[model samples]
Target chain A: MALAIKELLAVLKDKKGRIVLIMPPILQLFLFGYAASFDLNDIPVAVYNQDQGADSRELVARVIGSPHFHLYADIDHEQQISSLINNKNVLIVLHLGPNFSANLAKGPGTSAQVIIDGRNSNTALLVQGYLSTIVSDFNVDWAKRNGKPPPLASLKLRAWFNSNMVSRWFIVPGIVGLLTFIITTIVTSLSVAREREAGTFDQLLVTPMRPVEILIGKSFPGVLIGSLEGSFILLMAIYWFDIPLRGSLGALYIGMFLFILSAVGIGLMISSLAVTQQQGMLGAFLFMVPAVILSGFATPIANMPQVVQWLTYADPLRYFLIILRGVFLEGDNSSILMHYYWPMAVIAIVTLSLAAWLFRHRMN
Target chain B: MSPFAKRFMRLRGLIRKESLQILRDPSSIAIAFVMPVVLLLLFGYGVSLDAKDIRLALVVEQPDAQTSSLTSAFHHSTYFKSITFHTIQPAERALVTHVVDGIVWLRSDFSARLLNHGDAPIGVFVNGVDANQARITQGYIQGVWQTWLQAYARQQGHDLAIPVRLEPRIWFNAAVRSTDFLVPGLIALIMTLTGAMLTSMVVAREWERGTMEALMVTPIRIWEITVGKLLPYFILGMGGMLLSVAMALWLFNVPLRGSFLVLSLASALYMMVALGMGLLISTVARSQFVAGQIALVATFLPAFILSGFIFEISSMPAPVQVMTHLIPARYFVAILQTVFMAGDIWPVLLTNAAALLVMMVIFLGLARHKTRKRLD
Candidate 1:
C-alpha cells in the first residue's frame, strides 16, 4: 500500500504530468459534447415554389418555420434545383408543382419533388423524415379545418427509454467509458515499459518486493487514475453536461470498478510484454483503435453481423458500454447488469493473472 | 563531392538506417500493415448506421382478414422481423426489455374503422436509446404502412392518387449505403494513425535513449535527418493509403469516382502535413510516452471528431466549427469523400490541397526549428 502511494506520488509530482492527466478529459468532454450530434438543426433547405398559390405557400411556410431547417435559396428555374444540390448549398430542395393548389382541390395527382444530396445519406434521411412529418402535419390540419376526412392513417409514436430521443443522452455516457479506457490504458501500459526504457526496472527489481506485491503496486495506480478520470467525466456528465443518472450509485460504481480492473489488467499485460515504452505505447494504440471500434461506442453492436457480434464478446468495452448505457439510460438493475458484469470480472482476473505471470517470468 | 551530391548520399544512408530499424521493430510493421487492414475490416463490416432487420412486435387487438393482411405486410418487410402478439402489455414489456426495437399496435376497431371511413391510426412504441436508429425505424414503419395502405386501396378499386405525391430523388448514392459515407472517412483515420501516431515516437525514442547527442555530433544537417527519417514512414503511409483505397473500392465496393492521380496527390499532400505534425510532436516531447499521448490528442482525436467525417461540421456549435478549421484531417476527409464518391471536383480538391500545403509548411517549419543542432 505504501509503495503504491509512492508510485502514485511519483507520477503526480510533476505539475505538467498532473495537469496533463486532469485537463484532457474535461476538454475532450466539452469538445465532443458540443460537436458530436446527428440531430438535424439549421439544415439549409431550398424552396422552389413554382405554385405561388396559398396551399403551396403554406407548405413552404411550415418548412421554413420548423427549427430544423433554414431557408437557404429561393429558386425560379428547374436548373437551380440541380445546382443547389450539386454545390452542396442545401441538403434538401422542396419543389411544389406549378398546379399544386389547382390539383389539391381536384385531388389525387398533385406531385411535389424532393431532391436530397445523398453524400451524407444518414443526415439526408433524417431531414426527409423531419420534412415528411411537417408536410403530413400540415396535411392533417388542412384536412380537418376543411371538414374533410383525415389522410390514410396517423402514427402515434412514443420513444420508450428516451422520451425526447436525444442522441447526447446515449453518446455522453459513452464518452465517460471511452475517455477513461483510452487514458488509463495508455498511461499504465507505458508505466513498466517506461521504467525499462529509463533503466530503472533493474533498481526496482533488486528490492525485496515480491512479484505479486510489485504487480499489485503497479496495478493500483492505473485503477486509481482510471477511477479518478471516470469520476471526473461522470460528474461532468451529471452536473455540467446536465445528463440524468437514473441508476443506483452503488451499481454504477461497481460496474465502473470492474471495468477499470479489466482495462488496467490489459494495459499491464501489454506493458510487461513490451521491451520499451515506445513499443508499449504502440501496442496500447493498436488495442485502443480496435477496442473502440468493436466496443460499439459510435455504432450499435446489434447492427453488426452475427459473427462479429460474437467476437465483441471478448472485448471488455463492449460489456462496459452496455453496463454504462443501461445504467445511465434505462436505470437497469444489478441483476440485469450481472449478465455483463461477470464477463468483465473474468477478463480482469485472466488478464491480471497473465500480466503477473509474464512479469515474474521475465524477471526469472 | 559537391555539396548537393554529398547531402544526397548522406540522406540515402540515413534512410537505409531508419528502414533497418523499422524492420527490426515488429510493432512498427504491425502498425503499418496489420493495423490498417484490421481497422478497415472492422470499420467496413462493423461501423454501419444503416439499420436492417429491426425486431418488432405486432399487437393485434382484433383478429380478421384485413388485420392479418396488414400484419403480413410488416412480416414481409425486408427492414423488419416481426413477432405477433394479441395484447399490448406483452409487446410493451418486450420493448422495455429491448427484446424488440419497436411495437406496432392495432386498436380493436382498426379494420372496422378503415372499412367505415378511410383512416385508421396505429400506435407505435420504439426503444430510443439510439435516437438515430429509433428515427429510422419510425420512417421504415411509416413507409411500410403507406405501402400497405396503397395496396389495400388498389385492391378495393379506389383511385389511389393522393394530393402532393412526394417523389424523393436521392443523388450521389442512390441506394443510400452507409459504406459510401463511412469508407472515405476511414481513409483519413487510417492515415492519421499511421502517419502521425506511428512517427510520433521516432525522434522521441532517440532522445529518450540519449542517442540524440551522438547523432548531433555527426555531419548531417537537421533537414537531411528529418527528411531521411520521414521518407520511409511516408512511403509506409502511402502504401497503407493505397491498401485502404483498394479495400474500400474492391472489398466494400465504394466507388472511386475521381482520378487516381488526383487522389494520390491529395493523399501525398495530407501525408506531408501528418508527417510534419508527428515530427513536431516528437521534437516537443522528449519522452516517448508524452510524445505518443500528445500525438494522439493532437492528431487522432481531432481527426475523428473535428473532421466532418462522422458528424457534420455546419451543425456543430460555432466555436467548435472554428476550431475544426485548424485540424488538417478535416481537409483530407473532405478531399477523400469528394474524390471517392463525387468525382473530381477540382475546387474542393485544390482548395483543400492548398490548406494541407499551408499546414505542412507550418508544421515542417516548426519541426525544423525545434530540431536545431543546439543540444538544448
Candidate 2:
C-alpha cells in the first residue's frame, strides 16, 4: 500500500503526468460529444423543378421546411446536376420532370427523380430515407384530400431508451471507457519501462518488496487513477452532457474495476516486455487502436465477417462496451450484466496472472 | 568549391546520417512499415457502418395466413433475421435481454383490421442505445413494410397509386460499399501517423539524448537541419501512403478513378504538411514522450475524429465543423475520397490541393522560424 501510494503520488506530482492525465480525456469528451454524430443535419439539397406545378411546389416546400435538408440552390436546367454533385456543392438534387404534375394526376410511374452524390454510402442511404418519408407523407395526405383509401398501414415507430436519439448520449458514455483505457494503458505501460530505462530497476528490486507486492504496487496507481478519472467522466456525462445514469452505479463500477484490471494486465505485459519507454508506448498503441476499433464503439461488430466476430470475443473492450450500453440505455443491473461481468473477470484473471509471471521473470 | 556546392554537400551528409539513423532503428522501421499494414488490414476488414442481419422478434397475437406471409417477409429481407413469438411479453423480454434488437407487435385484430379498415399500424420498438444502428434499422423496417404493403395491395386486385414516387440515381458509388470511401480516407490517417507521430519525436529524441548539441557543434544551418530532419520522414510518409494506396486497390478492391499523377501530387503535398507539423512539435517539446503525447492529441485524434474520414462533417455541431477546416487531414481526406470514388474533378482536386499547399507553407514556415530561434 505504501509503495502504491508513492507510485500514485509520483505520477500525480509530476507536471507532465498531471497534464496528460487531466487535459486529454476532457478534450476528447467534448470533441467526441460535439463532433461525432451520424445524424445528417442540414443536408444540402438542390431543387430542379421543371414542372411549374402546385403539387411539385408543395413537396419542395416540405423538403425545404424540414430541418433535415437545407436548400442550396434552385436550378432550372438539365446541365446543373453533375456540377452540383461533382463540386460537392450539394449532397442531393430533387429533380421534378416537366410531366411531374401530369404523372401525379395520372398514376405512380416515376414523377420525381433524385440524383445523389453517393461518395458516402451511409449518408446517401439516410438522404433517401428522409426524402422517402416526405414523399410518403404527401401521398397519404393527397389520398385523404382526394377522398381515396389510405395507401398502406403506417408504422408507429418508437426508439426505446433514447427518445430523441441524439448521438451525444451514445458517444459520451463510450468516451468514458475510451479515455480511461487510453490513460491507464499509457501510464502503466510506461511505469516499469521508465524505471528500467533510468537504471533504477535494480534499486527497486533491492528493496524488501516481493515481485507480487511490486506488481500490485505498480497496478494500484493505474486502478486508482483509472477509477477516479472514470468516475469524473461519468459525472460529467451525467450532468454536463445531461445523459441519464439509468442503471445502478454499483454495476457500472464493478464493470469498470474489472475492465481496469484487464487493461492493467495488458499494460504490465507490454511494460515487462519493453526494455525502453519507446517500445512501451508503441506496444500500448498497437493494442489500443485495435481495441477501440474492434470494440464496436464507432461501427457495428455484427456487420463484420464471421472470422472477425470470433476475434471480438477476446477483446475486453467489446464486452465492456456492451455492459456500458446496457447500463446507460437498457437499465441493466449487476445481476442482469453477470454474463458481461464474467468474461471481463476471466480476462482479468488470465491477464493479471500472465503479467505477474512476466514481471517476476523480467526481474531476473 | 562554390558556396552553393558546399551547402549542398553539407545538406546531403546530414540527410545521409538521418537516413542511416532511421534505418538502424527497428521501431522506426516497424512504425513506417508494419504499422501501416496493420492499420490498413484493421480498417479494411474490421470496420463497417452498414447495419445488416438485425435480430428481430415478431409477436403475432393471432396466427393467420396473412401473419405467416408477414413473418415470411421479415425472414426474406436481407436486413432482418426474425423469430416468431405468440405474444408481446416474451418478445419485449427478448428485446430487453438483447437477444433481439427490435420487436414487431401485431395485435389479434391484425387480419380483420387490415382487410376491413386498411389503416392498422404495427408497433416497432428498436434498441436506441446505438442511435446510428437504430436509425438504419428503422429505415430498413419501413422499406420492408412498404414493399410488403404494395405486394398485398396488388394481391387484392387494386393498385395503391402514389403521387411522386422517388426514382433515385445514386452517382459516384452505386453499390454503396463503405470500403471504397473508408479505404481512401484511411490514407489520410496513415499519413498522419508517418507525419506527426514519427517526425514529432525526431528532434525531441535527439535533444533528450544530447545529440542535437553535438550536431549543432558542426556548421549545419537551421534550414539545413530542418530539411535533413524532414526529408527522410517525408519519404517514409509517402512510401506508407503508396503502400496504403496499393492495399486499397489490390487488397480492398477500392477503385482509383483519378489519374495516378494527381494522386501522387496530392499525397506529396499532404506529406509535407504532416512532416512540417511533426517538426514543429518536436522543436517545441524537449522530450520524445511529450512530443508523442502532443502529436497523439493534436494531430492524430483530430485527424481521426474531425476530418470527416468516417463521420459526416455536416452532422457535427457548428463550432466543430468550423474547427475541421484547420486540420490538414480534412483536405487530404477530401482529395483522396474524390480521387478514389469520384474521378478527377478539377474543382474538388484543385481546391483541396490549394488548401493543403497553404497549410504546408504555414507549418513549414513556423518550423523554420522556431528552429532558427533555437539556433540563435
Candidate 3:
C-alpha cells in the first residue's frame, strides 16, 4: 500500500505528467468528438445546367437544395468540369445536357452525368448514395406530377438503437476503451523502465517487498489511474455528448475493470522487457497501433481477411468494444455480456502471469 | 585552419556521432524500419472501409414463390449473407444480439399489394452502431429490393419507371479499391512517426542524461547539434518513405499517377516540418517519458485523426476544420493523395506543397528559438 502510494505520487506530483493526464483526456475527447467524424456536411458541389426546361430546372433545384450539398459555383460549359475536380475545388459536379428535358418527356430516359473525384473511394461511395437518393426522390415526385405510374417497391429504412444514426455514439463508447488503454499502458510501461534507467531496479529488489507485492504495487497505480480516466471520459460521453447508457451501470463498470487489468498487464510486460523508457514507449505504441486497428474502432473487423480475423481474438480492445456497444446500444445485461467478459479475464490472467514471470527472470 | 572549415569538421563529427547512436539503438531501428512495414501491411490488407458480406435476416411472414424470388436476390448478392426466418421475432432477436446487421421483412400481402396500388413499402431495420456501415448495408438492402422489383415488373409486363438513369463517372480509381486510397495517406503517418518520434526521444534522452551540458561546454554550436540530430533521422525518414512507396506500388499494387520527383520533394518538406516539431517538443520535455508522450500528443495523434488521410477534414466541425490547417500531416496527405491517386494536378500539388514549406519555416524557427546553451 505504501509502495502504491509512492508510485501514484511520482506520477501525480510531476507537473508534465499531470498535464498529460488532465489535458490530453479533455483535449482528445473534444478532438475525437468534433473532429473524428465521417459525416460530410457542406460537401462542395459544382452545378452545370444547360437546359432551360422547367423539368430539368426542378431536378437541378432539388440537387442544389439538399443539405448534404453546398454549391460552390455554377459552370457554363462541358470543358470546365475537369478543371473543377483537378483543382480539388469540388468533390462532385452535376452536368445536365441541353436536351435533358426533351429526352425525358418524349424520348428515352436521359442520364444525369455526375462526375465524382474518386481520390477517396469511401467519400465517393457515400456521395453517390446521397446523390442517387435525391435523384430517386425527384423521379418519384416528377412521376406524380406527370400522371405516370410511380416506381415499384420503395424501402422504409428504420435504424434501431441509434435513431438519428450519429457516428459519435458508436465512436465515444469505443473511445472510452481506447483512451483507457493508451493512458494505462503509457503510465505502467514507463514506471519500471524509468526505474531501470535511473538504476533503482537494484534498490527496489533489495527492499523487503516480495515479487507478488512488487507486482501488485506497480499495477495498482495504473489500475487506479485508468479507472479514473475511463470514468471521466464515460461521464463526458454521457453528459456532454448526450449518448444514452441503456444498460445497467454494473455491466459497464465490470467491463471497465477487466479492461484496465488487461491493459496494465500488457503495459507491465512491456516495461519489464524494456531496458529504457524509450523502448518501453515504443513497444507500447507498437502493440497499441495494431491493437487499435484490429479492434474495429475505426473500421469493421468483419471486413478484414480470414487470417487477420483470427488475430483479432487476442486484442483486448475487440472484446471490450463489443461490450461497450452492446451495453450502451443494445441494453445488454451481464448474462449476455458473459461471452465478452471471460475472454478479457483470460487475457488479463495470461498477460499478468507472463509479466510476473518476466520480472522473476530479470532478477538473475 | 579557417574558422568555417573548423566549424564544418566539428559539425561532421556531431553528425557521425548522432548517426551511430541511432544505428546502435534497436528500438529506434524497430520504430523507424519495422513499424512502417508492419503498419503498411495492416493498412494495405487489414483496414478496409468497404462493406461486404453483411449479415442480414430475411423475415417472410407468408412464404410464396414471389417472396422466394426476393429472398434469392439477397443470397445471390456478394454484398450480403442472408438467412430466412418465419417470423419477425427471431430476426429482431438476431439484430439485437448482433448476429445480423439488418433485417428485411416481407409482409403477407406482398404480391397482392404490389399488384393493386403500386405502393409497396418493405420494412428494413438496420443496426446503427456503425452509422457508415449501417448506411451502406441499408443501401444494399434497398438495391436488392429494387432489382427484384424490376424483375418482377418485367414478368408482369408493367414498366417500373425510374425517371432519371444515373451515369456515374468514378474517376482516378475505377475499381473503387480502398487500398489504393489508404496506402498513400499512411505514408504521411509513417513519416511523422519516424521523423517526430525519433528526434524528440533522442534529444530528450540527452537532456535527461546531462549530455546536453557536456556538449554545451564544448565550442560546437547548438544549431549544429540540432542539425546533426535531425539529419540522420531525416535520412531514415526518407528511407522509410521510399520503402513505403515501393511496398505501396508492388505489394499493394497502388498506381503512382504523378512524377516521383514531386513526391520526393514534398516528402522532404514534410520531413523537415515533422523534425522541427520534434525538436520543439524536446526543448520543453527534459525526460524521455514526457518527450514521447508530448510528441504523440502534438504530432502523431493529430496526423492520425485530424489529417485528411483517415477522416475527411471538410466533414469535421468548423473549429476542427480550422484546427486541421495547423496540422502539417493534413497538407502532406492532400499532396500524397493527389499525386498517387489523382495525377499531378499542379494546382492541388503546388498549393499544398507551399503550405508545407511555410509550416517548415515556422516550426524550425520556433525550435531554434527555444534552444540555448544553458541549463534551466
Candidate achieving the largest lDDT: 3
Summed backbone clashes in each candidate are 0, 0, 0
- The sequence of per-residue lDDT tens digits that candidate 1 reaches over residues B110-226 is 988888876788999999888888999999998888788778878889866555566788888889888898988988998998898888887788887878767777999877888
TM-score of each: 0.96, 0.97, 0.98
Q: For residue A320, what is the lDDT in candidate 1?
A: 86
In model 1, where do residues sit more than 4 Å from their true spots?
Answer: A199-208, B373-376
Winning model by DockQ: 3
| Every candidate's CA RMSD | 1.9, 1.6, 1.4
Docking class of 3: medium
Model 1: what TM-score?
Answer: 0.96
Pairs of residues at least 3 apart in sequence or in different chains that clash in candidate 3: none
Q: Please compute DockQ, using alpha carbons, for every candidate against the native two-chain complex.
A: 0.70, 0.74, 0.77
What are the per-residue Cα lDDT tens digits for candidate 2 across B239-300?
Answer: 88889889999999998899999999999999999998998888887677777788899899
Clash pairs of candidate 2?
A: none
For candidate 1, give the lDDT of residue B64.
98
For model 3 chain A, give the 10-residue run with minimal summed lDDT.
A355-364
